[model samples]
Target: MPRSPHRTRMRLAALVFSLTLLLVMTTLGIIPRASSTTTAFSFASAGDTSTLTAGDGLNSLNRLAGSRADFFLGVGDYSYQSSMTGDVWCSQFKAKYSNIEIGPGNHDTGETNDTSGTRSYERYVAGCSFTLSSQVVCGPVAGQCYGKEYYFDYPSVNPIARFIMISPRVFNVTGVCTTTCNAVAKSPCNDTTGCWPYNKNDTHYNWTASAVDSARTTGIKWVVVGMHKVCISAGAESCNIGTNLFNMLVAKKVDLILQGHDHTYERSKQLAFNSACTGFTTNSSYVLYNSSCVVDDGSRGFYTAGGHGFLKYAVSTDRIDIQTDFAGTYQDSFSVVSPTTSLSASFTYSPASPTIGAQVTFTATASGGTSPYSFDWNFGDNSTAQGNPVSHSYTKAGSYNVALTVRDSAAPTPNTQTMTNPVSVSPTPLSLSVSGPSTATTGSPVAFTATASGGTAPYTFAWTATGGSPSSGGGSSFTTTFNAAGTFVVSATVTDANSQTSNASQQIAISAPIPPLSASFTYSPSSPLPVLPVTFTGSATGGTQPYSFTWDFGDGSTATGQSVDHSYLLPGAYTVTLTVTDAGGQTAKAYQTVTVTIL
Candidate 1:
């Protein structure tokens, strides 16, 4: 997995059970550490998210962010209701998951005739790309970017893992409304049997089936399918997709199927369909749907109803261990073993490729081996460590071999395995800073200067912003403009001559422009006589509401309020001024000339 330099590579697998489900990403302060052998990543997923049910899903996502979860998968129904500005439900998801992946549910589509929830889903969900379209992950199911149907690689680039999101009740691959994403693709609908509402005539099915099949060819070890609705749920479920869809999934050898809609947790057994299609069987058995492959039945996993918690998985090259959790408690767990299961080793260093004399941490994670394994680290330079996670430093700068050997509890001789990789120790002379105004007016350009120190000659800068753009080139600084009023996270990356990169970030808040204030007033009596009672009406525009009003009657007496009565005694060619102050403290004045005649 490619590690983000900003995030600590240390395994969060240890703090998994300690933190509550409400912890957010930033609260988990990251320390510089090393990556592990097996990628211990967990993703929190739940659907039927609405204003009412948002708290639980949010807790799950927040906990995932705080932990080492690679990414979050929202089954669907992200929002119960849609707001014009998308602040209610959309912002909640954005605040939690800037890198969220979504599948549309029934509620998200019905909130609007067209795309309201979908639009927000695409806009706020960053950190997703289709560049690895066919590399262990499925991307752009039918030529649509982050379309309701798509897939992506998670946590890291290795261990060969992928996540597929399907929107059965909402739009299909082409963004067209369909009962099931793939229902229209199936030929000769079996209305006689009420063909699976979702998989029948399903175009998404063909595309998905093809996508997963192709992904499998790219050496994927884990393939998880997520959707808003499920097929094998129990207890008179109204929208039960039934066994037809389940049959296809199990038959096609999909590792796991995550669903929402019923809002209940239900885990299926290792289940599969009989070739004759009369009935299906589960546990300790699998069906051969193809000449060269076979898959377990659906009864191997358990479920939790009412959608209270989340599910986390430990993915590796050979096996996947999943835990069904609700409220920080593990309700159930099971392991799915893959055919390619074996002991493999991999590790990463923080301040990656550190300079000589720099402290470096290494974490070694092992799976596919017998329980109670021991690790040995060999740092090529005659330095070694016995434990899995240990820190070391290289006195000289150069490339060296770093290997980890593991011995598991097997037979009397213990099964042993070794894996090695090249570790580079180089001089790290890089520092970066992005300086700009912390606050600005909306729609105005904010000038930012990025300065870099140390690290080779001929340095280059790449700038990115939350609401604007900067010209791409080699330089020290650039400028960008923001249209929306909010805190924008801007970053600048400096690439040295050797292609090593260092980045710095700045937060800028752009506020909406202050409105101009205009004040006007009218008097009840145009030609008021001395001491005659008169009424004055005051009004203002183009400013924030709840304005403070003041009326100067030219008699050294004043009154307040939108409308007030005043008397002018012995008035002649007097000017009356109405002053208005808006909520933002902006003020404006208007004058009225009035003549008071003696009665």
Candidate 2:
């Protein structure tokens, strides 16, 4: 035992490799912890690989393969040719798809010869390691597992879920008639085999039902049954085998059925069989047995199947969301309402926070009843009912818990209800101010500005000038010109965001023009002129108002009153002049040469 260290290390390495291989074989699904919410699963049916390229199939698989879902289910036919060597390919496929759960299809059994009994298939089945949680017995025969069919539990925190895989060929008990036998004349089955009954009480029926019942007993909330053949489809000859299984599962309240045999993907409404009549078309009548079943009142019993595609089931406690993706596109989807929650109601409101007196606009959303919701608003103000987002003015300020209750047209009671945090109302004073350009000149344009200091939106401005060019403008400031010579007043009225207003006024003066005069002027007649009365005029400058004038002819003639006329006595050269004075008695004079002569 105390051998070389190298030998001990080699032994340990071999043991580790063996354990790793075993782990790989046993646990096919390995997912990281972060991507648990978005689990993806992919499936392919019988004969899909023969016509579809590996790239095409792989592309479809990648699309559905979310990072969380390390598990995948290969429902059926993985190989085109049924030969012993195909098992080698299956092994290769298993190695390649180490993360998937491999299910055996008819082609994997290498039973190409239709007449070669179940010997080859049995050998292949024995070699397969995949196991089911329950076994289905063929007829009353004990220990007869339906081909290689198996069931397993999917350990998810969501409602308990289970999957059932069955071989479509083994369930094909309704034999082709080469000779006539039992019950109806020209029947397909011989007397020993019993006319392959299509009823739910048939042997194959009991076997599948037992398996499902066993799975359900384990507290599985949803049972997803996968097979190669479909009950309702547009292609292929109609087979009552699917019908029998469908009826049995409906009676047992199975959650979902995933099937593919035809090249296209298809889906049917939740279905059940009516005992009133029998036929192959969708018009055949059957008793509705499942809670999710679609009622065919017009005798159209079966809903048409979808195209070649994979079925995805999102299982939850309240409902099962089913989607069918075909050729990389989601072709069909619907939800199966759980019987327990069918009558339950729920509602929600958006933008939860709303200020009081802010008109918190909201939509009352609802589900599980007739539409056109009836709205009731309880503002926690002890005030009664009204419509959604009902505009109510809060007189007093406080935190009030708001509740919205909605009842649909078909609801027996108000099933949808929503509540929000208490709305708060706070009041504050509105204020305003004016800025810039307080004073300006008359006949010259000027501008004044005003601004709101506080409050909310929708504020109004009403400007009234006490006195200015324009006396009043309903805005912030007044712009106008003053024509008269007097003191003018300008004012601006400002309104806050809350529609509160205030006024401010400024006074401006319009000045009159000053007379320019530092000199005086006078007028008189020339000398050597005719002896007629000649008047003299005088003018003075440099004063605001109230000036005096006087006239004096050198011949001892004088006149007054700002300006006066003087008469010439004789025709001789005599100096004529006039003087003017201000109220201050500041005087100035001017003279003109004159001549008094006879004409």
Candidate 3:
């Protein structure tokens, strides 16, 4: 459970200070790098960084990640998550790319055969303790967190976007990497011997579908899906045969698919995953090469690079520049954009500014797009809507940005047309509350303290009292003395930094000083046994009668009335206590002990 806002703020203050210090330290080479700034973020990636090869391929990639990339993401096989490779390679990899994000690869998971591979990968790659990886484990996989699926959003980008990572699943029927059902890599290709357990029938496929669908509806500029297994690749034998999963990504308009597994680098033209229509075969006899499904259309953009060559990507709201680098040289580069990327959709929020629980209606308008547009809305708070004109109410007060992605049409490839607007909800205005004695003697001085909440801080206070002389005043609290016995009103007005003001008044009743009261209690059967009842009588002196009595049996039970009885259920020495509240609202307490023995 989360703490109250006040407590959370206090806790955050200390953390904020620590982070600020750490931020400076990281720049000074004390701590590791953190997430990128909201303006821009770049990253490097690769798959098959197997230590078994014993080459400097990963060293070159590590240099790229350490110097130029804001972070590093692996397609899967880093050779760091497997017991076979041990922790040396993984630790070195992490040391260089401290902020690395990844999906489990076959090599990382014991060549897709050993369960320990999954456990090791989960502990190292997807562990919550990897504070630098941006490992955002949201929602559930297989009804509970398997540490294999997670998603994150970059809200600070020119147009906010989301990235999703899903685990490679076990094949429901044919135990082959979904993408490599038949395209198993040939000689010099480790894939032919073993492959990922991914299959279209597995739950992960549905998870991928649901993720891309939700990303589209949430107004994300791009849904970049990543995993360790290549769906389609070259320079490596028979990669993923997951035509079913590819088709789903294409239909959901997934903008990017980052994959690994093959030992080569190749780029496919924009194409769909429709193997049935593309005339690709599922049998290994015909689908001998990566050219089976030629990239020609905008369905599945299959790109692969071999030999530890890393991929670098510069992402933005306008365009994405992708490059495959091997030995520090660029192998291929490409750019991608949607036709509706230039389109815009904006919404106007009623009241300009909102208050807690206020119903704010957002009216959307789209431009630079064909008519009959479809609107997908993201309110920036995890909730979403689809209609052009939507109404929402917020429970908390904070500034929020609402995103509206409008698509001109559904047929063919839809473009990304986003129009964003921001709304600020103010907290329930400043409130003033004063706490002090309710009753006091005539000509006596009483002290009161005033407090303010819910508005900008650094508040100024003004105090006023009737039928009383100010003994002291100013700054949230004051002391006042009364001369006559009467009811007096004390009001406190508070003004915040924004000059907003509110006032609250409390009534103080002054009377002739009553004699101080003395409280005493007597109980029958001072030496009682277990389960025996004892009656207690409370006596008081010098105060108004018709007093209320409260008694504590000290055995986890309580009673009320001037005289009452209680019983101890267990054998023990207990204290019987009484509190007498006089008619004048004065209270006094007294206690007595009783021994209950086991009989």
* Candidate models: Cα lDDT each: 0.59, 0.47, 0.60
Please report, as a residue range, the 10-residue window in candidate 1 with the lowest summed lDDT. Answer: 17-26
Residue 63 lDDT (model 3): 55
Q: Which tens-of-lDDT digit does each residue in 1-599 have in candidate 1?
A: 22222211111121111111101111222221222237456565555544423344446556656756555566665554334223445555556555456666544544232343333444322323232223333333334446366676654555366677765534332334333323333333333221224563376566677767776887877777777665443323443444445556666667667776554343333333235554334434333222112124545444333334556766766566665555443355545554324666667667676787788888877776566789899998999999868889987768989888987876677777888878898765778888989999877878888988666657888877756754343467777877888888888899888777899988988889976889888887777888888888998998888899998888888888989987776757778899999998889999988888876
lDDT of 2 at 379: 67
- What TM-score does structure 3 among the candidates reach? 0.41
Which candidate tops TM-score?
3
lDDT digits (tens) for residues 1-599 of candidate 3: 12222211000001111222222232233322222323356766665564422345545644566557776665565553224443555566665556666556554544443333223444444332233433354534333232246776654443356777665531211122333222233312222333323345455566666767777677777677776554554434344535566545544556677665554344333333335444534442222223433434554443343323566767766455665565533344544433432467677889787887778888888765445788888887888999868888887878888888888754576656787778788976788889999999897888889989878788999888877897336887798999999888888899999899998888889999768888998888878877777888888997887688898888789989988878788888888789999998888999888988876
Shift of residue 95 alpha carbon in model 2, Å: 3.3
Which ranges in model 1 have alpha carbons more than 4 Å from their true place?
Answer: 1-37, 52-61, 82-88, 111-143, 169-202, 238-244, 266-307, 328-330, 339-409, 412-599
Cα misplacement distance, residue 100 of candidate 2 (Å): 4.7
* TM-score for each of the candidates: 0.40, 0.38, 0.41
Counting clashing residue pairs in each candidate, in order, gives 36, 28, 28
lDDT order of candidates, best first? 3, 1, 2
Q: Is candidate 2 or candidate 3 better by TM-score?
A: 3
- Model 3 scores worst on lDDT over the 10 consecutive residues at 7-16
